[model samples]
Target: MKKDYYEVLGVGRSATKDEIKKAYRKLAVQFHPDKNPDNKDAEEHFKEVNEAYEALSNDDKRRRYDQFGHAGVGSSAASGSGGQYGGASDFSDIFSAVNDMFGGGRSRAGGGAPFGFEEFFGGGGGARKGRASAGIQGTDLKIRLKLTLEEIAKGVDKTLKIKKQVACKECNGSGSKSGATESCKTCNGTGEVRQAQKTMFGQFVNIAACPTCGGEGRIIKDRCTSCYGEGIKLGEVTVKVTVPAGVQDGNYLTLRGQGNTGPRGGAAGDLIVVLEEIPHDLFSRNGDDVVYTLAVSFPDLVLGTKVDVPTLDGAVKLTIPPSTQPETMLRIPGYGIGHLRGSSRGDQYVKVNVYVPKDLSHQDKELLKELKKSQGISPDAHNDPHAKSFFEKARDIFS
Candidate 1:
């Protein structure tokens, strides 16, 4: 059974575009397959999130879904089962949109076969229609890489070890021992067989890939020993990825031709690297800007001091001006994260948090009493119109 789109995303029916995007991003990061490897439940949740976002993110689909529910949205992305919809064409449109969003589109290098779900389900065929009978492209793979604030602030290189299909070294992906094969009698080297049936409407012809020889159009006398007859073998492969600086969490990088090798020496798929930013101990990210809270004592605020502030680059000296009020926000220009695609750097904001001593020493108490006397602030100064209010007095402490 299909779940409601809003329910799947944990959003309200009245959610706006931004809210919908934020909710989807949060869920995508949490339930992403890379983050929860070997967990089927997480994978299911990831699909559910994708299905919900695909429906609600679009204005037309959202309107249809709001009125007619899942049936209104046509095919759910999670199931990819071309159920009853407005028409047969809707299935392709829905899945195509989803595939593009999930990094399953055509190869980034251009003129390559698709790794979309349509191809996997015998719809798009990955390769061009005429060439699909000759070559089958490999499946795309996704993995998550966690980066610290320091690494993200500056671009870093990463090495990943993954087990994926590669062309068998022995047979050179020909699937035959001596690289020799004979045409199949079933399809007569056409790679497809035709079946004719009589229906109520008229005669119907069904064209399907030949089962014998598995659509290769030829039979191998001696199959490859390394990869059996599949022409591919699973092996551990090392892939190097260059992560650009300022890449936000949940954003992904695409490495062309680094995924599983295609069957029968077809084009290899892409490797999608989704980045996860590890939380920083002292800094919080807001876009490219970094937020930091600096605690200062009353004397430090009054006397001013040079303090060390932590930034992605390193610790730097920040000057606190004399008589600086609490909650003063100081901007350190160009100390935050760099632009992902540009050279501009964001600023770091230091918010001052005043700290008060709860337990005063005996001499401190006496000094405070003397200071109050000198300032002419009586114990009953609350009734004085010129006196500071409770809020004003506590501003530094609460700010």
Candidate 2:
């Protein structure tokens, strides 16, 4: 028996269109065949998710399914046939949903397949049935790039070396030694084969790529010796990337057409660079601002002093007022990381820490004993009326 469409997608019956789409996107990515290679259960779950989405994504089909379940919509509404599972246009909708998730909306010129569909499906299946002769797009490549806090503060340019598939130079990417090819006998040069299956509902016709020619419509009579007829080989490429300021960890940048070159004179893919921020030894970042702890001696805090603090650029003088409390934060404007989009920069916050001597010498203790006799040196909250409370100081630090 067919499962309930809402149950298959794990959505409520009254779920909105966006909610349904969100659920479908999550399930599709989880059970996609490419992500779960050689797993039969995952493949079945993928098909089920696609079928459920096909029926639910459309208003009329969803209404019919809601009223009479699977019988009302039938396989025709989901697959464009009364007996089959899915068709070319049905998969196109699935590809559209996936493309929207990845922030890619560009399609090939002259209405070819969408940008990521070919990469995910290998330019085969129903999406590229009629355009089998058209060259396939290469798969996208991803690499993690480590960036230092200093580099992120000031945007830096990086050159990366990538190893990927490049077109074979021997055959000039034709995959034929003599540059000669013949029509495929299985598909009769049409690049596709159709099969009719008899089911309980009716006859369903399925059209797919030709296996003999691998959907290229033509077969190479003489295979290339270097690439073994695949027209691509493992090679290295150098790519330059510019990273903007204030880009956080897990942020990524995409470079178009910088990835692996497709086989048989096909278009190239994209390169995805994911940013990873290296931990700083003396500083920690909080949004655009950076925080550093500055330790000062007890004598320095009692009597105002000037000390140098470390910054990304260099050392800068910081002022400590007389009787400044511990855990007080001092702000240095325009000294932190630069804003991502604007010229303005965040402030650098210095957290004050009192440095206490672990072991005092005999002379140091005698001097401290004489200073302890002074009434002003005793701990008294009434001594300073302007002194801020702990709660007030904490609020100032965070606010």
What lDDT tens digits, residue by residue, belong to model 2 across residues 1-399?
A: 777889989999999999999999999889876677667788677778878888899999889998998888875754563123433234445555666653443243114444443243333343344452345677899999999999999889999998988989998877888878888899998777766644332333545577777667778878999999878889998889999999999999999988788777667789999999999998899999999999999999999799999988889999999998999999989888989999888888999999988999999999999999989888666456555476567788999
Q: What does the lDDT read for residue 287 in candidate 2?
A: 94
Candidate with maximal TM-score: 2
lDDT of each: 0.75, 0.79
TM-score of each: 0.61, 0.64
Clashing pairs in 1: none
Off by over 4 Å in 2: 1-134, 381-399
Output the TM-score of candidate 2.
0.64
Residue ranges of candidate 1 with Cα displaced over 4 Å: 1-128, 132-134, 197-200, 358-399
